[model samples]
Target: MKQVVQNYKSGELAVLDVPVPGCKPGGVLVRTAYSLISTGTELMKVSEAGMSMLGKARSRPDQVAKVMQSVATNGMSATYRKVINQLDSYTPLGYSLCGVVEQVGPGIDDVAVGDLVACAGNEHALHAELNWVPKNLYARVPDGLAPQHAAFGTVGSIALQGVRRGEPQLGEVALVIGLGLIGQLVVQLLVASGARVIGVDPDPARCELAERLGAEACGDPASAAVENSVAEITGGLGVDQVYLAAGGGSNQPVELAARLSRDRGRVVDIGKCRLDLPWNAYYEKELDVRFSRSYGPGRYDPEYELEGRDYPIGYVRWTERRNLACFLDLLARDNVDVEPLVSHVADFGDAVKTYQRLKDGELKAVAVLFRYPEAVEEGEAEAPSVAVPAVRRGTSVPAPARSGRAPVRLAFVGAGNYATSMLLPHLAQRDGVELSTVVTTTALSATNAQRKFGFARATTDLDAVLGDPSVDAVFVVTRHSSHAELTRKALLAGKTVFVEKPLALTEEELAGVLAAVEESGNDRLQVGFNRRFAPLLQEARKQFGARTGPASLRYLVNAGRLQHGSWYLQQSTEGTRFAGEGGHFVDTASWLLDADPTSVYAVATPGNEDLQVVLDYPDGSTATLSYVTSGPSGFPKETLDLVADGRALRLDDFVRASVYGRKRWVSSRLPKARDKGQSAELAAFVKAVRTGGPMPVPLESLVATTAATLAVRTSLVSGAPVTLARGR
Candidate 1:
């Protein structure tokens, strides 16, 4: 097996063909899939190795002090030999990795051979083809989570431990003084905990990336923009917590932490930064200083990590292994996204060159991964493509009698925030609805949904939900990547599917769903395009009356920034932002124009931060949709206008609407809140399910809207109008 090794004294890195580690008792032998590089901690070590002996001594005064004490005790000759031997020998690299178990030794029962697991520990999870990881240092990878993402478990655990140390609370303001890999993860964890974050970094690009990930504001540490943002968010009060995730010789991080922290605020050190604290500022604020050890309790303990000794959960809630599992669960549930943090994925054979580039500053990255040979081979296979079968209209299972039938048993495949807040809440207490089973990738999330929404049962077994004859409908509310696959399975199982919009990320996935429909002869499916069902917009369209000529429709979606760790930003795996959301606007426009679009043209800003999509209808009418993220948060999210035949209609963010013609008409302002039609949509869907009627939205219209939505991406890439093919 080949492993990455470094010589401290010679400053040389090599991918050496070393003996594969044996499957020791109380541990498992794993075949490496992917390994992560710690850009901050590992690079610092690399740079120190390249330095001369005197320079190395200067960089580590503590090691030098230890060396002097050793010399006094053991004499200069013995001490000198010991120090030289240690530096000249090859040392293994990497502390985090994802791999498939090849062998499970005695005393370990949690995992078995061939199971994928994320391993932690420098000695156990090295950058090698195979490793022997003790039971307590490895966690089973969550289902559907990519192995490359699981490789982030260790560093993610470190960030999670750091956030736990800070003791952040809901709605508190936090200032993160770094934007590196760990810092970025910390920012996301804080956001997930319901705290607002302000990020500081010297790199403008990093600061911008931080903001895109959910930071309220980010800028250079020296810039006034960061200070103003902190003041504005906290109402002139200092931030509740300050996290020092920066590394350097300067004293700025500690000083800034003291200056920005509120009175008695907690400051946690999570990185190897200069800690020369300024006494006066800290004394004035009386801040509580804390240090977060890597990966929480049991991190460096031999008994826990090497001997497989488990900690009592009642006393130690989160140990190293537990933290690893927690972070992996967060990744599985789409809560803390790491896909955006990945800058590069290099082959393991290029390990030496990759390290040199990073050390020489030739490569700029927040995080990098090493893909083993097996993973690379698997990745090279082409994704299967299937022809989209012809749409079979009005084909569905016969509905039972509407009178006194069992409540429509609906099973939800995901329990994320969107499902809980928008979809489940509407159906939870509805008279004719029964929340039967909630299936999630994580057991905890399934249990949470079962507890909150009164689900009959909760389990991670998706097969059980699909196979159950009593489950009348299945809601595919998981992340964008899983929608097509889940929907196809449910449709095959003869259950109605209510999937959230952006039905598919690619044409192939879309075709697969249609193929399933053709194979099963069932078209009982509804994509969650709730905008068309909005009562306010529906009423406005009715009041505007018919139009003889081509009408020009304008829809502006002020899609503001996503939270720092939103799964929506995982473009590589989940699809682009516009690809996931552009369907809603297209569907609504088609609903108003009363026809499917014949052509689509699209363009984007330089970094694809904003988009303008133009759709041409069969009647020569047109709709222009502008989706921008640079808009102010205080502004409304969705607003629309339609004008033709000397008449105009406007809908103000679903709050109010007006029509102008021979007789002017306007809607009364909505009192408590704006309704985007989730409740109404659910009601209509349930009614369709009970009566065996057609879907609320026609099957052809849904398919056309999805195809038109997909065309925008094609047009953006081709820089030309894409004509929508009508029919098979």
Candidate 2:
């Protein structure tokens, strides 16, 4: 399927053929009929993307601050690669659409496979032939409503929510500034509520359209006509409420709003416009300022949007989805007219040209819609495969062993920041290693990886990479929730698998991977536990030597706060912070103790932001791991110590190490850069694949460490030690 995408680095727009997104649980696969374009919001993004690097940085100071923080944390070289990769990739467009449900996923019962629905959300309601919309982001369209008009549901909801914020009373006069797409809708909604309306905008055509749609009067903001209309509507006072629905850098909208609003009247901002209020005017009137967040009450809450969780109607009278449904109802009843707002309708195939025309000012549109190809008849559409295909059962084929001289061909499933910055860089230019293919959900990310790392091919199909017999190893560097399942599939396909930790979020997932190994008779697996392979730590252990008594180890990981909107915080789906990251510390501790843990006990600070986990080995040795997110940013990320037989080994992050034995020894000097042993770990895995030798870490040890990491959650819940089952 083809989707509209734009390259942020070059500002190049294209309709690229990418893989059809799967219909996951809690959502429905929708075949788009029409998709609405936000001339105000999307055009701003397109314009910003076309700017130079410096211009882009100047446009988004918030993003620049994040880049600076990343540089301080990961160093300049790593930050540069991450930033470049993000900027060069293609991002999707469009957030409002009307579509027929092609297939229903699990947990979706409100709408069926043939339902016509209006979808909202930039991530879900994209300008493609198909979309996967979660339950909370889509509402069923009313009977007899055209799909093109239903495409206005999302934007109409924005207008409806803004009007609700103003609390406009019957017979009250309201002023709506900036007669764009949303402003026009707001004008009609206010009039429908029995409130007289005055509209303001510089565009004479838009102002005319607003008046046609029920505004009492309309004119340009610079003209005295707007002020005169507002005063006349409110009997020489001012309008009772003001809705600012404009978008631009100019502060004229807010100033005009303050000038036209009655004393102590409400002011609602419904669009992304400048908010430089005229302080004295607003202060003297004591205007009640309110912001109508995109859609409504549940806009940014992941639980409400992605997890199918709904707020109680009593407490939250109108959520984003409810607003969407209400707007569609109003459209169906002919209370809100959208026909005048339809400025243009372009074919989906010409999406790139359409965007270019809009950006270059060749197209003047208040609202544009992309008409997709006709949908198939009801009951004809079959459910597509899920995002990740299930691991086939009863597989027993073993991969062909490779000669030592043969290059170990690798195909990567995810090209995220960690994979590009730390893993791929180590293997990209290495001899006797082949970067065969890079597969990602987005076509441009795969293409970016191929361009940067010399991959032989790039694609969005996971099956193609897994089915290829030439690929020797598959790197499962995706999100934590997928590691186990992807690893299981690769193992069943008879390919060596290297997955990043934590290996599995639950015991069931861990059992699933082990079951795959048993079914396929293949155990070539390596989890990313690179910290144990650090040269500094190894030297310290060598100097400390074998101990007569059980050793005590302590590992401190300053796992700081995640940035806002990070997927890591999607704990409902991705698992907890500790569940996803604790395996690294557990594996490192187990490696230092030279044994798998027998039991695990854990505790956390209030709210579970920080955790302390204790693991016990069979030989009476114990290791304590401290994972803290509230630590100071400047503090070292990781520090460890091992003590036994009157000897102590200390590691300061990965930069230096020391052993306090009979004859004291320390690492020569601090290294120029920190090496967490990613390169060495990759080398070991490749060598094992090439030579058909045992994995760098034993399968049993890997399983045990994963079990220990998972047990932390159980211990935290049960408030007792969770004993590990031995002899897997």
Best candidate (score: TM-score): 1
lDDT per residue as tens, model 2, 611-675: 89998887899999999988999999999999999999999989888999788888876647898
lDDT of each: 0.87, 0.85
Q: Once superposed on the true structure, which residue ranges of model 1 sit more than 4 Å away at CA?
A: 378-503, 506-516, 519-575, 578-728
**In model 1, what are the clashing residue pairs, if there are any?**
213-563, 213-564, 214-563, 214-564
Candidate 2 stretches greater than 4 Å from native: 375-728
Query: Mind giving the per-residue lDDT tens digits that candidate 1 earns over 1-728?
Result: 89999999999999999988888999999998889999998899889999999999999999999999999999999999999999999998999999989999988899988898999998998899999999999999988887888999999999999999999999999999989999999999998899999999998767877776778889887878888888888988889999999997988888888877889999999999989889999998899999999998998899999998989999999999999999999999878877667666677999999999898888788888888887545531111111223586335446544555668889999999999999999999999889999999999999999999999999999999999988888999999999999999998898888999878887778888887888787788899999878899889989999889999999999999876667786665788788899999999999988998888887665345678999999889999999998899999999899999999999999999999999999999998688998989999998888777888997778778888877776555333467776656
Error of 2 at 394 (Å): 70
Candidate 2 Cα lDDT to native: 0.85
Q: What is the TM-score of each candidate against the true structure?
A: 0.62, 0.52
